[model samples]
Target: MTVDNIYDVVIVGSGAAGLTAAITAKKNGLSVVVLEKAPVFGGTTAFSGGVAWIPGNPHFQDRPDAEGGTRVDRAAVHDYMRHEAGNKYDAAFVDAYLDYGPKMLRFMERETEVEFTPSLYPDYHPEAPGGAQIGRSVTAAAYDGRRLGKEFKRLRQPLKTITFMGMMFNSSNNDLKHFFNFTRSPVSAAYVAKRLAVHIAHLARYGRGVQLTSGNALAARLAKSALDLGIEIVTEAPVAELLHQDGRVGGVVASIDGQRREIRAARGVVLAAGGFARDLARIKALYPHVREGGEHFTPVPEGNTGDGIALGERAGGHLSQGLPNSAAWMPVSKVPFPGGAIAFPHLVDRYKPGFIMVNPAGRRFVNESHSYHDVGAAMIETCRGLGRTEAWLIADHRTIRKYGIGFVKPYPMPLGPHIRNGYLRRGKTIQDLARQIGVDPETLAKEVETYNDSARRGEDRQFGRGSSAFNRYLGDANHKPNPNVAPVENGPFYALHIVMGDLGTFPGLVTDTQARVLDGDGTPIPGLYAAGNDAASIMGGAYPGAGITIGPAMTFGYVAGLSLAGRIADHRAGQAAE
Candidate 1:
């Protein structure tokens, strides 16, 4: 098929936001095309957990009594936002997300074939205003790749940390439990039995299983729906330069197979390129501590190296800063998975009983059981003048065996491999383990004593670790009093060094609530738009829930489509009158 000379909407980056923008614009009566830089479609969203935090969704409001679906209160949400972002809160931006998010979601569901199932995962700050313990986070239902026929293999697979045997994929709680806890319960056994049977049959027929869920499912479903609608997706076409007309962005100069081609757009170009995480230069500029054992810990994909940001800025778009950090941080640990080295985000690992995080000084700084973002923020804050860049996560025998610590599998799973690889440190005594990790042995012993006492009492007085609802949700349910605390007085302890791993870039192009890119002077640059990490988060850099990132990305992408499409409609009306 020949590439079109002009499109109504030319979307840069085929991640959730770009795909969403292309889909919405196409449905809204605009000829759309998605430009993907990577050979495969779907950016980091395909590798993500795919929980979208969309409060006040119509799907949840309709179900009411559904597990993760329920009506959300607007006032409560406002309260949470105000408290989270304080005076820096973008009320109009957030209001735009809240007002249009549900409509966008409903529109996609009705018009497109994409499906979302309510996820039982709680918000990062469930105690915050309007936070729903459940309901808000919605995950994409499993997608049968077989439906895509020959296109199934073209879809990007899940990250190695997510799959088993590099062929099986799980996207939700029940699915993961069935796969990971295969021999634990009868239900799990049955689930695995069917999965194995299907795996064997599929391996024989297709060499890979087609049961896709979570982020992979979401991206695949969007791609399938877009393909079905005849939207031309040009892969391996990276946007080199945005076409400009009198200080306005009209299209993009894309690199297609090592050759540069100018792609035109009638309405505008939406910059949804992932982020600047992979760019070492940007990372050094953002976090001055980059050289100090930081990027060695970062597992972000190398593709997201600020292409969108550079294009937007060259077009006079301004970058937003000063909310939290330049990027959304997550406590990450590296481990060797099947295909390659995997950066496993440490969320559940921190909240479970018998795990504690300590700095190089061997002192517990933040509540280990808190949100991953919060923990990472604390890690950064704690290391400001402490001469330490990373923290160590100490796990006792029970924590490592019962609930795997980071990359370490449970009791039945051997840790010898991990220990041998130096991904984990083990010792019969706390002092010995401390020496292995370069922490003060005396201070380590004291920290353990203090933590063990708190665990026995079922309370964390130092940092209030297990006091929150969110903490308890991620904690071990079997534990009494506090599910987040357990005595660390067991022999054969394990320790893993944790680093501040960012999920996606937090701050990017500054845009108005309409998803129009704003200039350095705070003026909206015509024909320019941005969403997802390519745009400064509408939440002003504070994470609220599981899918908060994806929710806004898709919503604003929807908003950008509607806005630009309307502009197209208006232009046509004016031309007709003329």
Candidate 2:
């Protein structure tokens, strides 16, 4: 398709946010074009779990005959999330998001074929002062990407191999028992056998199946909507600069196949390109500790290099500070050699009772089983105290043999690297392992003795770790006294070095509630807007729940789309009246 004139709106980045904005603009009767730098459509959104945290959504309302008497009111959800975020979340932004998120979700559900279901996953801060047990996250229903035909290849898939319509392992004793029973039950066994047969038959009949799970489903839905709306998506089209006319964004200069081309936006231009997670130099400059010693692992594609922020900065956009706090850092097992190089988050639940994590000083820091966000914060603090950012995961041979520790059997997949490489350090005793890892053997031995004494007493007085329900939820079920608080007694200890890493940088071009790109003076740049990671996160420094990024990205994209269309309509009306 050839275009001679400017469209109503031009969107940069075809990820969840960008595509959502383009489709919203089209629905508002505005001409729109989406430019993506990658050969695909969905950016990080395609690689995520696709869970949107929308408190007080209609989907959470009690259904007739539902087992639980749990009722999630608007006020309750708002208060709960606010409290969960330590009341530091932007109140107005959260309010606006909660108010419009349901409507926006319904619009996608009705207008497009994007089916979704409320996830049974508990909130990350479930045991927080006012957190709820469930009904905060939503996931897209499986979609047949074949519906998009050729457009299917342009969509990104999840980085992890998540199970589709299978029971989620909650990393708790009760949950594990339930899982085992479900697999062993006669009816469940028969159902699984039938499902396997059906899958085999589908594979035989067609080269691919239509069951979209996790992030893939979400990406497929968004891609389908863009295609259905006739929104032109130019892949490998990276925006080089924002064209300005009289101090206002009027068009964009983009590089397509190494050729520079100019495209004008009659109404406005929206920037949704993701953050710079893979930019090693920028990361090191911003986070010195992480660069020097912290572990950095990201499953994001190599193309994510801060192109959106660069283009906007070139056009005089203002960036926000505190970028160091925006990343998702956690301990990860390194990938092994011979074609296996993927790093998986060292989930504490998977560690069982035989292991524990400690700092370079040979002392237990935060609860080793905490969420990555919490662990990341702890890592940062540990680094600050030690004048360096480095930690180690200590475990025993029993833990390795039982849970497969780092060397997950699926060779060439996410955890295969640990098995292939010597990253998994092993020793016959804790002291020997500590010496091998360059840590003080006496300090590590003392720390372990103190921890084992606490475990023997079935209490964690120092950290109060095993006290929380969430903590015990991820503990080993077989432990008699307590699942979470266990002694690392068995010998043949191992240690793996860990560094802090993040999914992407958070802080970027500042935008308002409407997602209009603002200047250094805190004023909106005319005909210019930003969304997704390219803009300052609306949640500030706190992560409220899953899908926090994608939720606001879609919400603000809708807002920007409407805002652009309204501007074009007003302009035409003014001209016609004159």
Candidate 3:
């Protein structure tokens, strides 16, 4: 915690990646310290789904499904990565990750409070070669926040949008069915009542709900593991530069409590402090600012401004280029909420029934029911053509009452506020809605007519909306015919603007299979490594399913630990020889 303090491993960013590296390094008998730039621990991982899409996971070993099929195999994992990565696939990286990924998960389970379940979430590309129809993604078992005690206050909270009334929303089928069945079914009503009773009791005690899932639970588990191992986690400590010793990376100079502090690393420094989503200038250099004239916002913590990328650059680390996306992009909507304007990532709502996306030309472009990354990427390409800077999501009163559009809550909740805030536009006719949103009236009218006809037939001949398992998984489960297909045929329609939002920045420092940061000539920067968004992703430009980000993050963090131990030993041996 002081200048000149030295540790065997110094990890920047206290998210899943950084903490995993810290834990694994400690497991290897290395003294480790984690420095966080934000005011609290748990970077974006705390606000995430907390699912790790690691195939060959042991949790699925004896797990059986309602349909009686096991979920994973090593071969299937290989097929998925190969197919998803396409031309950008890295065989050695995939092989290395596959070797260590499950090992890391098992180690965490055996050694830490981090428990995982072979969750029923489907793959994003379920039909891909070797992809599991059910999925290999595992959700973090819910942790009671009170166990951290006062330290729980130091854990970053999940995004307000991901939670409901300050309580983390469980996304499992049974959990969701309870919420969706609020007024319709007695079973759902009872489930909600029981959940509310527990939540209320928790709120009275912990000040936050007791049930922690998603990223919050993931962060808490990792943080608790570090705490258990006597690892020091220093928040509000920003690494200013990667220090060098004899032309090799040694440690870091950071700013803590507004004072410059030098922390010497005896072995190596791992960069996992997230990516450059908040660094608008930096992001614009790689991606065109298509959101400038329209709606665009990121739900990631504002503290994420590419500190790791910047420090690595100063230390001669090479930033990667031409990723599938420079960030984990998603469509975001800005809507006025109780306290202020909240930028909400339109995840489940877009893929649900009764919604359509149109660019400035009032013509439908991408498949609305596709994965968020795909939809956002398509929006980027759509914007590039003919200077179209805006897009809109349209839905009918029925969809709004059932699923909620943008920030507007379901029916029974008054729609007046959203309409007043301009987050939603209401129109009695399709042509009127088009004019209200500045779209060509006739073109939008035609698009609507065609879409309505397709919905009636339970098919989208244009985009194949309900075709994939992943797509249907996100759609209305109880809907008839195709869950993703629904007619927007009623009057009093709603619309919200779309923009490029991302889970986090991508295309970070180029690294080898060992998770060591690379140089311009494709050499590892000695004493330097990266994981999570801090390093170029192993998944190339594709998002295969849930937890892809966190899965590789923890895997390579473990790899970084193992690699650092070897690198340090080799360096020591070389010194002894000298």
Q: Of the candidates shown, which would achieve the greatest lDDT relative to the real structure?
A: 3
How do the residues 449-546 of candidate 3 rate in per-residue lDDT, one tens digit apiece?
A: 89889888888888999999888887887997998999889878878988778898768899877788888988888899999998988888788888
TM-score (C-alpha, index-matched) for candidate 3: 0.92
Off by over 4 Å in 3: 1-4, 62-75, 289-295, 337-340, 386-388, 567-578
TM-score of each: 0.92, 0.82, 0.92
The all-Cα superposition gives candidate 3 an RMSD in Å to the true structure of 4.1
Candidate 2 pairs with clashing backbones: 294-499, 294-500, 295-499, 295-500, 335-417, 336-417
Q: Over the stretch 258-341, how does candidate 1's per-residue lDDT look in tens digits?
A: 888888898899999897888777777776346444543555566899899999998898788786667778888878656666
Task: Go through the candidates in order and give each one's C-alpha lDDT.
Answer: 0.79, 0.68, 0.82
By summed lDDT, the worst window of 10 consecutive residues in model 2 runs over 569-578
After superposition on all CA atoms, what RMSD does each candidate show versus the true structure?
A: 3.9, 5.7, 4.1
- What C-alpha root-mean-square deviation, in Å, does candidate 1 show against the real structure? 3.9
lDDT (C-alpha) at residue 281 in model 2: 74
Rate residue 39 of model 2 by lDDT.
Answer: 87
Instruction: lDDT winner between 1 and 2, please give it.
Output: 1
Give the TM-score (vs. native) of candidate 2. 0.82
